[model samples]
Target: MGNGVKAEIIAVGTELLLGQISNTNAQWISEKLALHGVNIFHHSVIGDNYDRLTSLFSLAQDRSDLVIVTGGLGPTDDDLTREAASEILKKPIFEDQETMRNIESYYEQNGQSMSPNNRKQARIFEGADILKNDVGMAPGMAVQKDETLWIFLPGVPREMKAIMEQSGFPYIQNTFPNQSPIFSRMLRFIGIGESQLEHELRDLISAQQNPTIAPLASNGEVAIRLTAKAESETKAKELVQATEQQIYERVGDFVYGYDEDSIEETVFKLLKEKNLSISAAESLTGGQFVERLVTLEGASSVCNGGVVCYAKSVKENLLEVPKLIISHYGTVSEACAVSMAVNVAKKLESKIGISFTGVAGPDEVEGQSAGTVYIGLYVDGESPFAKRFYINGDRDMVRTRAVKKGYELLYHHLKQKNY
Candidate 1:
């Protein structure tokens, strides 16, 4: 029902302004509000100053019907959100007796003294609707003034989430029953750059309207989030899926999973479906590749295990890479990676094997530059193949990219074979 009502989020903290912390509260609240067809017009981050916050609040009330604020709800003088609201609304901060007793009891249960400052958390804007904080000491509040709704929440992510999920979400849902909820789905892709992927889907992105397509990139992967607003959840999902199909016609091969699926999870699912057991041999990526796989519940069924053959001697003695091959390829070549994968598969008696050998460094290795990576995949009774990559980033980034590349290679291989 609140589809056309505009909303503004104000994050109150000096830490946000100083760059010591991010204004994630605004991002999270905006997302939640948008899902219920609420329009967010502005995001503001203000320091712990009474005059400035009051002015910002008044500005928000002038233009927006919904004002959501986070932070400055702590038991300290710098926490000025309540004071600012009181001043702007011409109201006094009143103590809710039950809330004060609850605050005092919290300290008692923790074997600590309730400092006088702790009582400040119990004070609320006069006549405001109180939102009990189940997870923290400071409670939240919602107040209405002059056709605008003001939602005040704690700054802590944990407490804020709890209060919103417990009370705020229900309150909004009940108040705006006719809203066409926005639904979003994310399609994740690996082995592709953001620029290239967006270029391929440029037409779909440019012509988007009801269901909008937005491309985002982070670390070694790219994601496209499709958001659709419909009267019903089913209709919203259908709209998102229809747009997804259009994008898939162009760049579907690079998409490894949907929504929250990670590269490792996709690989694990493929291996299980193909009934193939897998092993790994590693160098620069250490045990990171296998370690991530094993975190999944059913990994033990398809994951035969892996070894971190970091040292040259270990590659020779443990994975049994031929001394001549290591010497000729200098341990970072496709030949060495293939040999490591082949030998590890045989050593572990797995149906499939993967290996990572790379130069992840601040300095060059074996005359090769840092971020030079090679990933090898060997299926039983088939020729082993290795992919080479030169990633850009620090040592950890190089290593992480190598792991993702390993999964991408395996996932594509399985897909090609109709697994």
Candidate 2:
């Protein structure tokens, strides 16, 4: 039998339509609902137009047992979710005295006067359960009518996340006692094409059911998301792990990090664990290499510093690369790349040094073609290593690929030491 509650997430916001902000709320709600055994069939994003929202709501009620809406719950006139919801369901709404008092008290606590328009936030559908919002002024709500449940949450991510975790999730779990536990693990991979990875795991994907293997490609990277459904989380995880082991036997070597692993984060972690410090001398990547490294916490422990020597003179003066090397081999040459790494490591007194110098372009530089990248990596107490790659796509693509390659280089170096 199908799960009793088939839910649909409706993100009501004009800005979402205009691409002013992503519909991240829908994604968050989907994950939350899945944990509560709520089946999310569709995700719909509609602007704040009342007529359109009413049509969307009617469709949702017809097909789904539960409708969860985020956004358009603000106090402004354009905040039309509640208005549209009230009209579509033909449910008369009144301001809950408790919510109104809370809103007033919030303003009082902050030493600010409440606007008359802010009173709109206190209104709820008659007989609906009021869900308090500890994060914001507008109170959330859960309405029940004719075997259908509607939950309204604020658009703000922090506010929506808090209310869902604290109130909405537990309430739904209690309401639906026979909910299955949802489990999934993402296997991240690099150094392989999606087509190639799929080809290797074709046998596994062909034979999936309760535990499913889905391979997906994003940007230039590939991943396999393994998911399972079972009565309990432990059983679900067992189901997933069984399939993961099978896939691993087939194509595990290509796998890098699991779930959400930023290339830089993985590299940084490895470098820190190994007690290795790195410095950078950047050219085409500008400061992107160092910028990405510093983005992670505890970067200072693993990074000495970097010199973004974009100019030929700066490379010679600041990074102290030999003038003869640049003049003879040009900046894009392996010699220049290797020298950039070695000299910067000496200058910063760091053990490991990495360098990115290349022609990324709408046009080529020196005699080198566009998308021609050379990276220099020098580990402390070891001879330096340099790799040359021809990356495809435009200027930004070339730069992005270069950064990913930089991470791959560091990861491989760390991996070799462990082995």
TM-scores, each model vs. reference: 0.91, 0.93
Error of 2 at 262 (Å): 2.4
Candidate 1 per-residue lDDT over residues 319-373, each given as its tens digit: 9899999888789999999999999999999998999998999999999899999
Model 1 / residue 272 / CA error / Å: 2.9
Cα lDDT listed for each candidate: 0.89, 0.86
Backbone clashes in model 1, listed as residue pairs: 1-178, 1-179
Error of 2 at 373 (Å): 0.9
Q: Lowest lDDT 10-mer window, candidate 1?
A: 169-178
Clashes of 2: 0
Write down the TM-score for model 2. 0.93
lDDT of 2 by residue, 303-328 (tens): 99999889999988988788999889
